[model samples]
Target: MISINNLTFNIGARALYDEANWHIKPGEKIGLIGANGTGKTTLLRLIVGDYTPSSGSISKAKDLKIGYLNQDLLSYQSDKSIVRVAMEAFARQNQLHTEIEEILEKLETEYSDELITRLTDRQQEFEQLDGYNIEYRAHEILAGLGFSEEDQKRQLNTFSGGWRMRVMLAKILLQQPDILLLDEPTNHLDLPSIKWLETYLGNFEGAVVIVSHDRWFLDRVIKKTVESRKGKLTPYAGNYTFYLEEKGIRETIQRGEFKNQQAKIKQEERLIERFRAKASKAKMAQSRIKMLEKMDRVDDVDDDNPEVNFSFRFTKQSGRHVVNIEHLNKSYPGVPILHQADGIIEKGDKIALIGANGRGKSTLLKIIAGTETFDGKVEAGHNVTMTFFSQHQLEALTLENTILEELQSFAPTYSETNLRSLLGSFLFTGDDVFKKIKVLSGGEKSRVALAKALTADANFLILDEPTNHLDIQSVNILIQALQQYEGTFIIVSHDRYFLDNIANRIWFIEEQKIKDYPGTYQEYEVWNSKRVIPKPAPIPVKQEEKAKKEEPRPVMQNAAQQLKKLNDELSRTEREVETLEKQVKEIETELADEQVYSEPARLTAANKRYQEAKAALDLAQQRWEELAAGIMEIEEK
Candidate 1:
C-alpha cells in the first residue's frame, strides 16, 4: 500500500502538484486520468521515487515491491532470449537452481553429506518458489502478450521497440509486485493483447495505478478513477464512465454555487456603494465590506472537455467510389501478408481497419495511399482529393515553423483565423500556436500533423495510428472533427473506443485475404465472437447412400420411418438452438447495460456465459443444417 500525503511537486517554477493527496489501498484498480500537461505521469513518478517532490512525502509499506512500466522501457536491450528475460523475474529461484546444479556437478565427482544437505535445502526452496515451471510461466505470458513460440526464443535485442516493451511488460507481470504503475501501457498493444492484459490485470491481486488514454480498457479494468487537475487530485468512486458522469454533476453544482456567490457579492457591493454616501450608514457599510472581504469566494469550474466547432469544407465532391483494390497480392520473402485480396472503399465510408499486430493493417493503408509498392491495382475514384496521416509524417514537419505556420504552409489558401481555430481545437491555443515545431513534444507534433492533415480539405483520408501520442482530450477533438466531416476515411488504430464511436464499418485481414464486416465495431465483436464455426465441408456420402444408388431405394415404409426419425431429431435440435440463441441474447443485453460493464467481475462473468452460449448455439445450428440437407435429399429421392 502507498499513501501520498500533501504531495507537492514542481518543475522549476511550474507547480505540477500542490498538496495533492491520494491513498492507494491494496487490491484497488485505479485509473489516473486527466488532459495532457496535467501531471498524471508525474504523480506516478513521484510515487515511484523516480522524481523528488518539492515538499511532503510519499510513504509506502516496509519492503514493498513495485513494478513500473513506461515508455522508457522501450529502449531496454538484452542479449538473452525473451523467455529468459522474463524468467529473470524469479531472481532467487534462478540463483537456487544454479546452486543446485553446482551441487549435482560436485556430487558426480565426490560425495559429501554436507553438500547433499545443502542441495536438498536448495531444491526445497526452489520448489517452494515454483522455480521448476518458471520458464513455462514466462512462455505463457509472452504468448499471451502476442509472442509466438519462435518469437519467445529470439534474442530480446533483435525485436523492435514495441515488441521489446512487451517483453518488459512480461517481466513485470512475472514479478507479481505489490503494486503496478503502468503509464500508457496499451499504446504498444494490439486489440488482442490489450484484451489479454485486461483479463490479466483484472485478476491481479496487488494495487494498480494506470494512466492510459484507452477509455475502453479503463472502463473494463479500473474500479476507481482519479482526476489530476489544477494541482489537485480528485477521486471518483467508480470507473471512467462513472467519473465522466460524476464530474459533470459536480461541475454543474460548482457552476450553480459560483453563480449564487457572484450574485450575493454583487448585491452586497451595491448596498455598500449606496450606503457609503450616507453619514448614518457609513459605519454599517464599512462593516459589510469587512464581511465581504472575509467571505470565501468559490472558484468557477474549468472546461476540461473541449468540443470541435470548426467545419471541414472541401471544394469538390468525390466520386461514388473512393478507392477500389483489385487482386491485391502483397507479401514479403517468407511471410504471406495478403494474396489476391480485394476491398472497396466507397464514398462516405468510415472504415476501421483493425486486427492483431503484424496483420498487414499498416501495409494495406500504405497500399491505399499509393505510397507502398504492390503487385496489384489500387485505383482512386474521380475528383478524390486525398490526405494521409501517419506517425512518420510527424518527422516531416518543418522544425523551424511554428504550429500555426505549419498549418498555414500546408493550407495556404485557408485563412489564418481558420487555421488558428483548428490548432486551438487540437489543444494548441494562442501563444502555444507560436511555439516552434522543434520544441514541441511528440504528442504536440502529432497534433500539429493531425491539424495539417485536416486543413487539406480532402474528400478521402487515410490515417494510420493517428491517436498514437494523443491524450484523451486530443482524441476526443479528433473524433469530433471526424464526426463533423463528411469525407470518407479508413483508419487503422488500436483504440477501440475511438473506432467504435467513429467507424461505421470494420475491415480485418484474415487468411491472406481482406475481409469486411459491414457493421459497427460493437456489432462486429458480437458477430466475430460467434463466428468460430468454420464453413461446413462437403457432407461425406454415407455408405448406405453410396450403396443405395447402385442397389435399389429403400422400401416406402422404411423411408417413411427414417424420415420421421430425422424430423424428430431436427425438431429437438431446433429447440436447443432457439434456447441457446435466447441465452446469448440475454447475456448480450446484460453486457449492454452500463451497470454490468462498469463492474469488472460482472462483465467478465457475463462475457464467459455469452461465449459458452454462443459455442452451443453454433454447434446446434450446424447440426440443424446437416439434418435439413438430409431431409431435402430424402424428399428428392
Candidate 2:
C-alpha cells in the first residue's frame, strides 16, 4: 500500500537514512525499532508527509487513507467531550446520515419518482457506510482505551497530558484508515489497555507501522521488524525475536569477513614493503601494491548494542515483614479507591501491583510509602529505610543542576570519581554528566532518577512505573540490578516483560480490594484464568422445598423426566468448562515461550481464544452448579 525507493533523510548535517528502500503491503504489521535518536519517529513523519525527505521518493496509492498518531498530541478542541472528539473520526459517515435524514424529510412533501429514487440511493449509501454503528464502535474503542463513561463526558482539557494522548489514539483507531502509523502508542496505556490494543491491532485489516520502545508490546503486535541505524534501514522478515537472532548471525559473519580481509591486506602490505627495496623483486612488489590498491576493503562491523551496568547496595537489613497494612481505605469526595484492604510484605518479596488506569495502583503505592495520607494503618518494619521513585521524581530534580550535582545532592559525601562512575553505569559518560538536568530528555531524566535511587542505602523500595521513559536496554539493566538486590520492593509498571522477570508475587487491585497471588506473573495468569469462575449463589429454600414436594407426587414421572434433562445439561456444561479450561492452560503455556510471544498473530489469537474460553467456562460452571443443586434437591425428596 506504501512504497519508498532510495529514501534519503537528514537531520542537520547528519544523515539518518541514505538510499533506503522499503515496501509495506496491505494488512502488514511492521515494527520500527532501534536505539533512541535513530530517526524512527522521523521516518514515520516522512511517510505521513509531515516532513519531506532530503532526497529520493516515497509514494502511496492516490486514494488510500492514512491515520498517523504522533508521539506528541496534536492540538484539538479542548472544550469538546472525549466522545465528541472521537466521533469526529466519522465525519463523512455523519454527513451521509444527515443527508439521508434530509432526503426522508423531503419525501414527505414531494412524492415524485425522482425524489423517491434519490432517497433510496442515499439510504443505501448510509447503510453501506455503517453509519448506524459508528457511535457504538466509538464508545467501544474509547472504553477499551481506559476511558470511563464519566471521563468520556468531561471536556478534553480536564484530562492529563497522558490521557489526552490516549484520546488522540482513540480518534486514530476509530478512523480505521487503510494504513496506520503509530509512534509509541503504548506509552500512556496500562497493562489491560495495552492487551486490548494488542487484540485490536491484531484484528485490524489495514497496513500498520509502529515505532515503540516497548519490547513486549512490539513482540505481541508486530509481524515484521525494521531497524533504523547509522544511515541505513535493515528489514527482518520475521518478528523481533527472529530479527535479534538474524542480526546476531549477520554481525558475526561480518566480523569474520572483516577480520579475514584485514589479515589478507596486512600480509600483502608486508610482502610489498619487504620486496620493494630489492631490485630483482621490484616488479613483483609493484604488482602486489597495485593489487592491494584495487582490493575491496571490508569496513569493520560497528557494535550497535551498548550495556548499562549498575547494582543496588543495601546498608542494613529490615525485619522479616517489610510492611504491614491493615484496614486500608482511601477515598476522595465521591470516589472510593480502596476499601478495607490488608496486605503483608515480607523481606525479599518483590511484588508487582497491576490494574487498569485510575484503579488505585499508584494510590496504594503512595499510601504504603507514607507519601500520601489515608484513613488506614500502614506500618513499616524495624530498620526499614525506603526509597521512592515516581514519574514526578524526574520533575522534582533541580533543573539547573548538572547530572553530577544531582547525584551528589543525594549522597553529598560521594567523591567526584564515585559519582561519575555511577553516572557512567547509567549511560551518562564524561561530558554527559555535566549537562544540566533541564537540557535532558525524558529518558535521560529517568536515568538520573534511577541512578539516585540505586545509590540510596535503603532496604525497601517503592517504584511507580519506573520504566516509563527508559529504553528496552535500560529496563533490562534495571531488572538485573533489582534481581540482585536483597530488598523488599513494590513496583507498579505496565511493562509485562519487566514485571514477569523481576516480580515474584502479584498484588492485583480490582473492585476496591487488593488480592495477593503468590507466584510469578505467568503463574498468576494461569491461576487467575481458572479463578474467574464465581461461586454460584445459594439455592432458595422455597424453591428446594417445592422440588422436594413434587418429587413424590403423581408428578413423579414428570420429576424423573426433569431430572434427566438437568443431568444432560449438567454433563454438557461440565464438558464445555473442562474443554475451555484446558485450552486456556495450553495458550498460557504457549505465551510463556519467548519465541511464541514474538509472533503477533499467534499471540493475539491465543489471547483472544483464552478470553473467550474463560468467559464461556465461567458461565458454564455457574449453570452446571445450579443444575447439580437441582438434581440433589430432587434426590433428597
Clashes of each: 0, 0
**lDDT by residue for model 2 over 1-637, one digit each (tens)?**
7889999998888889999988999999999988766788888989889899999999999899999998667455479888888888998887876775575555455545676566558656766887656766776788778775556777777666667788899988998899999988888887768998999999999989988767788888899999888777889988778888999999899899999999999998999999999999999999998898898887788755544344566779999989988999986544566789888999999999986666678879888878888987899999999999987788788899999998898887667787787776577876999999999987789889988887888999999988876666667777877888888999998888899999999998655678999999889877875532222111111111221111111222355776787798888888888887898788779867866544444544554565456556665676688789988876675
Error of 1 at 43 (Å): 0.9
Whole-model alpha-carbon lDDT for candidate 2: 0.79
Clashing pairs in 1: none
For candidate 1, the per-residue lDDT at 534 reads 21
Best lDDT goes to which candidate? 1
What do the candidate models score in CA lDDT, each in turn? 0.85, 0.79
Q: Write candidate 1's Cα lDDT for 333-431 as tens digits.
A: 445568899889999999999988776788899889988889888999999999999987988999999888888888888888878878887778879
lDDT of 1 at 72: 89
Task: Give TM per candidate.
Answer: 0.83, 0.79
